[model samples]
Target: MFELHLRQKSTAFQIEKRCKALAKVIKARRAPPWPCVPTPELPAKVVSDALIECYLRTNETLLRVLHIPSFRRDYEAVWSPDSNPDPTFLVLLKLVLAIGATTYDESFSLRPSAVRWVYEAHTWLSAPDFKHRLGIPSLQANILLLIARQATGVGEDLVWASVGSTLRIAMYMGLHRDPAGLGPSTTTPMVAEMRRRLWNTILEIALESSLNSGGAPLISLDHFDTEPPGNFDDDQLTGAEGEVLVPKPDGTFSQTTTAIALRSMFPQRLAIVKYLNDLSSRGSYAETLKLDTELRAAYKTLTRTLQTCKTPTNGPSDLELRAVDLLLRHYFVALHLPFFAPALKETEFAFSRRVVVESALRLWRAAFPVPLSQLPTIDDPLARVAISGSGYFRTIAVQASIVIAVELTSLMREEESLGLGPVEVRPDLLTALDDFKVWSWKGMETGETNTKGYLVACLVWAQVDAMRKGMVEEEWVMEVVKAAEEAETRCLGLLEEIEARGRQPQDAPFGTATQGVGGDAVVTPDFGVGDWDYMMSDVLFNTAGDPLSWVFQ
Candidate 1:
């Protein structure tokens, strides 16, 4: 049995600690025995095939967890007339299908099945003897399970801890060292390349979870000397012993191209995360500028090389471009977030605010080129998957929305002070708010971070609305205010429904209880009760009452 609760802590920087504290929700429980094999839970072959293909097309670009050709061969054997697949491979197969279900459909109709598959895979990995039996397939299963969990919103908040443990395992497996350093007898060229690829994937995911959780990254450049994967597709390297391998030309668009390009700046990104989240000693503004410059240079290299790749369609797809843009621009926002609000008051730091706002705007545009209501007609299906299937990406969108709202408030305040022309809120602000409300409604069904996100969104939206109307008591402003208020009312109602559901008693399904051993029920945070509004206010402002002044620090 387990319960989720907000951590209540006091510190010197009390407001900032309280704001960042929302990210951590601890669970109290003990492990239960692993379930039996999930063979009966497998979907039809046709359905499974479609889901796997979906995962390959959308997620495999960044995740790079599995070699496509190898996985395809294994997949074929799984359905053979007289074949028996390996147990570990079965675990990997389930995870692939679980993640595929999310990418295959934006509505996630198969989410329940996906969740079950993830839990089963997790149990297999949790066995005591599993570490003794660790191999490439087991490592692959661990990585894929993390992706599946993120896609299905299972253990979404605990990804950082899981990734940390995975990091230690990879290091213990000697993946941190380039396989070339090992004797040729120990690893073939194909195995060597796969090792490098897997290590890169592990490092990337670790950094991502660290950023999402606002924790220090477990990786540092000094901690690993593994070389980057070559620019080659899965088919280029045959798995034969003593086989020589050749990489494709730089201009060619191979499967490993994006991963390689990102690795070029992995050190800088790691430094950025460490600096942003480091509690003991953060770098100075000058150091932040240096990282900014390096990141921009790396981004430039990524675009130039990726743009030159001669695909059958002529260039990279829109989703590829958007995904890359959103990812790199997020660093731009985080790099300057500490100085953003201060820049509004001090002309010297205005550049920081400019960077934050511009980067955040670009991030928002890339993440949502079209409004949420028009999702069905979106040109790039991969973009839809990237946005809706991954909890990490959704968190980025929420952060960007808050940035937009904060900026809009500043603009309205300026207009009021100068008695200037009306400040028009960008259309994308409403687009993001609409999506926030949609997510909130979905949270009513699923019950998790989405509800809290929407509640914060509503508060920010109302505050912005008030400021806009105060600038000029106009009819249109009033209309917008009314709409914002209505959204808040609906959001509060949904929160009530969610809390009501959380209060109900339930039997243990996956060997976890809803109630404690002493008949005490699990306690859920009451949004309508004491200090809830104060918490939201703390998120929106700092102790000085300056809007959007709260950064991760």
Candidate 2:
């Protein structure tokens, strides 16, 4: 019995030794685990590919990680403590990566792994506990890092989408924090840069996608899901007493009073009436024209108050008030210009024009003034003819010139339809158009640089209209042609300057060559000049041919 026991013990010891050796070998063969060293050879392309693979393979794990309180806290502490991870980021990133990878290797594509990572990150960063622990600064940093890491060409859409979410969240958080103060340090710079980049990217993507698909419809703003504010509840705010409340997407609430006011001002719901009334009492008007006037007055009054009032530097909400007022003024002006023009009497038009011109002049002179030597010789016949001895008079003259040009163009078109060679040119109308053209061109060339484009385009359109009617004399037609040529030259030169400053290559010229009046080949000017294509196109087409013939149609 003793000998048998000894043999068993010996066998057991041998077996144990072999097992230990096998365990050691297994561990040695495995990857050096925990905080695995990031691969050094991983190019951006490779990393992107790996990410996609990982996402596909371990989407659940990534999602779980994202949801984890600790992980979210850490992420928020670095990038966006106050906001949730934007879901847009995931979609955009996937799309971009898919496109980029397909470019180099068709087989390389966004997989479940990438999706998983995105979900995980989102879950982790959104936990309430994590948000509280992470400060804004840390959160912003993390956001930047996240974008930097995943912002490859393939994932640009995702990044941009994420950026939009981040901005909304940041804005909400900032507003929540102060009710008035703009949010964290990253708010201004990040928002501005993202806006600019996103705009360019969106344009390029839209154009390229359209081109590639042989006119296939491109993605639109409607494709993306935008979160509406939770506070938007019209029914809850509406009352039987005819009060209305309008909830702005930006979180502000407007109230209106009176049945007409409620319907006209907040057509969506009667609940907005109270809000409208409240704002109106503070100078908001139900009628757009009145509103514009009120807003302009508010700006002027507030500015004057700020100049005399004792307040903190950039404080007392003066600048903010002024900005809001200006925005409102511009909004009303644009809204009313189309349908309400005929309703405005001659006196009203003259008064409004005077106000606009004087206000613009005041703003310009305060910001930038011409030197004595640079000022135009007002005594000259041309200058004297342009200005009717007063600013208000000059404004009327300009308005009259525009009206005459339009009328002549209309008459000429009618005459042509009747098979008449051309319409008769009234001397007074011709003179007015020429004078306005000269005056406007002078303003474009020598006035406040800020208003140069606006003045030039306005003048160019007037000239084109006159020329198209065949009512303009040959000399005046020549002048109009010269103006067009000069405008084109100036625009090209400006574009070149911009390209030089940006260190970007010049783009190819656009449009086809068409015969001019003398049968000389003149390239139909490209509409790409000076970021004012909307205005320029009107001038080019209205004068040259049918206005409706364009891609925009």
Candidate 3:
């Protein structure tokens, strides 16, 4: 039903108008149908439970997308439903409820209707005239919906593309740029600060999408002059007037500035992503070291209270700990982007072996399963910071596993040249592959059409899952050559299955295709997933002479 062509469009002024019109047409087609709902008013208990789940669990862990400390105040006003209704707020409330419902299993009595509640929120969001009301709350609602898709476990991934409208609408409303030039009415310190936070949030989301979507963000520093959000929480300001600085989320002043700690790092990290986007033009290692120093300098310049990522001798506040975790994952993102540089591709291993190994270690710490005593929040047995994550975190897991595996082989090959210590990837690599398979299953069980996990399974030979299948340990770790051959044969079979599916004439799925975030790369009709035509052996085997270092040294 759709063509999946990867074309490079020339930058020219000639087709700007035509491009805009075509975009609108495609977006309109992507819109969901008028969603059905019973009513916006739900019982106070249901509402309370959901908000509690959101703040205590979802907000901190999976969906740290909101200005929670402030949004909580606004959310409280209409949470009981005695006031006049606003459509945007209503959407936010419903999505909050949807994410709340997903925190538990279906056996809970209120869950089925939560499904209806989610669609009801979309109904308000999808209203034709709703575009006219796009503003701060609308942007908030769109981001919440996007986060909830992964948090709730029932929503589809491509459906998350609905935020494409939010990005555009926010741009059209001029939320991307600071409104200082608009008028005095738009220039209040309070309003100025709000614009900064919202704009930065949009930038962060756009940048995140760009990573997997392979598309550049609609927002760039060149187009926007908005300053970074101030460190204050929402209650510090009253209406258009602003005052009252708070150093922490709990209204105490130890040192760490509340809320915007993560936001502050967005620009530097985003620039790194863009810089590494082109494989052909990797700067020299010295250039990377300079960029690395610059990035670390920005990080180090933060106040001591802001350095919560260092595992303080005194325990950190929950908010500070979350910041620590988030910063670590983002650091790996910055560290690994350059590994994708073209120069790395010239060699059998990823471009930068040192950064790859370092990133893999750090990311493993971020997403790796920890003992219960080490977990920041352990309210429920099933809850995990990474469990509710969208594929991004798990994608990191897969990348780390593969990269570490590459390191193992590379070390074995270069043992004579570089006297590197022995490396063992069995446990960490097994864990990473396990995490990947878990997420791939969740993505599918929650209504995924792509059989992505099937592909990841080919990598480790399901070594972890083999125990579940009653296979003895020796069966999986058999001699390397036979394992490689079997992996090749199995991979070919999976590729053939995909090829067969492509050949069949099938109707397009109901909604309009979600355009991928990538503007430069080719995409599958389903979006970023591409044809797995290159054999699995491409990644599975690497050697100096033998060319098949499947096992570690």
Candidate 4:
């Protein structure tokens, strides 16, 4: 039933004959030896479980965004190094091997060696002549290295240096410009196609890193004419004129690939956001609303695979993880669009307070199916992409917690305004906060304790006391609202204090912080957007001046 998952399997019989002749030479003139680092050199013949783990980890996680060329030939080259020893390719292969060892399987007993391999790969890059070897191929190594750092869950900012350099290197290669647009140019079809794939990969990495870390993109969309990758296997693609090939498989994304649907969807969505960012003046409310709709439409258009997952119970299979990854992209769009709303807007604006609350609720609910409490570690499938890099799961949970808490109090106020007796607070609101706490404990394990606790703590307590009304139903008092405000202020103040002390704020609930090595501040998650951003997703409200920001219509 399993079709050809990897091309290497399909062609092994034919390749083995050619490989036998080459292996003799590779065995004689073995790979460039770095004796100091303890990571083992790759063997020229059959790969062990260790290499498979590396390839699996690298392919599953990094290829979520990094779309590189075909692996079969490149991999064969690794086995036949004497035929062509591309150092940059070697560096990329090592990084992939390193990541596999570090992240692919927790049950994988070879973890210590995976960690060693990561260092060995870095040492390979640190060699004195590495600079001289920098070229387009080196871009692939740099990206893989960044991904390895991210996958290790100790994501730091050492990648910023890599990112900044990657943009420049891509520019030098004319990767930002489409070769197809180059009328009268004679660049071969194979080369042009490869450049297109690599460029899109760089953009995904750049956009994700920028948005997640609050860093600016290395290159803007306006500069690039390169197209998203075609929905075909590399074998089907050829340099010959007018050649058509196999289409992307119908159905869901592969757990091991950057799906063609995503490769197509993500770049367009990013382009919309980039356009919004570049606007010199805020667009008219109608214009802004149109843009918001565009983002949501993109989400609706995503072609998701139907993965029937039994989460945290039997755990998600690898296919289920790919399904989760695709849906998370929708969450990213949902959380982002509402960020532009001004809750106090006119009727013309579609991004109302209701839209914000609903979006937050969708995000909160999404975290449940394989919620953090059920998972054993941060490396679990549900936690890996959302938790490790952007701390997006944490951000959505806390943001939703605050918004829902505020909503409960606002409802009571509405009843009082209509001259009716005060209504009781919803039990669901209280339960949601407790659920958030359960989700947050994993983050606390990673040094994110205070921020997660403070989000709905005092607010929920205050609301519950009012709902109980000292065991007697009483009219809602303005003092309840005031108390909630004071508690929020106190929470904000505490988070500010933490930030002042140079520990990342507790306001960024549900995420961990990794101090940069040697005081470098390398891969710290910018999981630090203030909860206030959600209260003003429309971004038109000045929460600073308003007394009851969340209460606005």
Q: What is the C-alpha RMSD of each candidate to the true structure, in Å?
A: 14.3, 30.9, 17.8, 20.1
Please give, for residues 336-367, the per-residue lDDT of candidate 2 as tens digits.
33333342334445444444433433322221
Each prediction's total of clashing residue pairs, residues at least 3 apart in sequence or on different chains, is: 0, 50, 6, 17
Q: Please rank every candidate by TM-score, starting with the best.
A: 1, 3, 4, 2
Give lDDT tens digits, candidate 3, residues 76-122.
Answer: 55443344334455557667766565444322233334455565665
lDDT for position 312 in model 2: 48
Task: Tell me which of candidates 1 and 2 scores higher on TM-score.
Answer: 1
Candidate 4 wrong stretches, greater than 4 Å? 1-90, 97-136, 153-162, 179-191, 214-222, 234-258, 266-268, 304-350, 371-380, 388-432, 446-553
> What local distance difference test score does each model get?
0.66, 0.32, 0.47, 0.46
- Residue 220 lDDT, candidate 4, scale 0-100: 58
Tell how far residue 203 is off in model 3, in angstroms. Answer: 1.0
Structural similarity to truth (TM-score) of each candidate: 0.77, 0.28, 0.60, 0.56
Q: Rank all candidate structures by their lDDT, best first, as comma-separated numbers.
A: 1, 3, 4, 2
The global Cα lDDT (0 to 1) of model 3 is 0.47
Point out the higher-scoring one by TM-score: 2 or 4.
4
Point to the candidate with the largest TM-score. Answer: 1
Mark the regions of model 3 whose C-alpha exceeds 4 Å error after superposition. 1-34, 41-84, 100-118, 150-164, 177-189, 240-259, 278-289, 302-305, 308-351, 369-385, 405-553
Q: Write the per-residue lDDT of candidate 4 for residues 366-482, one digit (tens) a residue.
A: 555454445565455444333322233444456666676666656665554565554665665556555555554334323232432533454355555565453222222333344
Better of 1 and 2 by lDDT: 1
The model with the greatest lDDT is 1
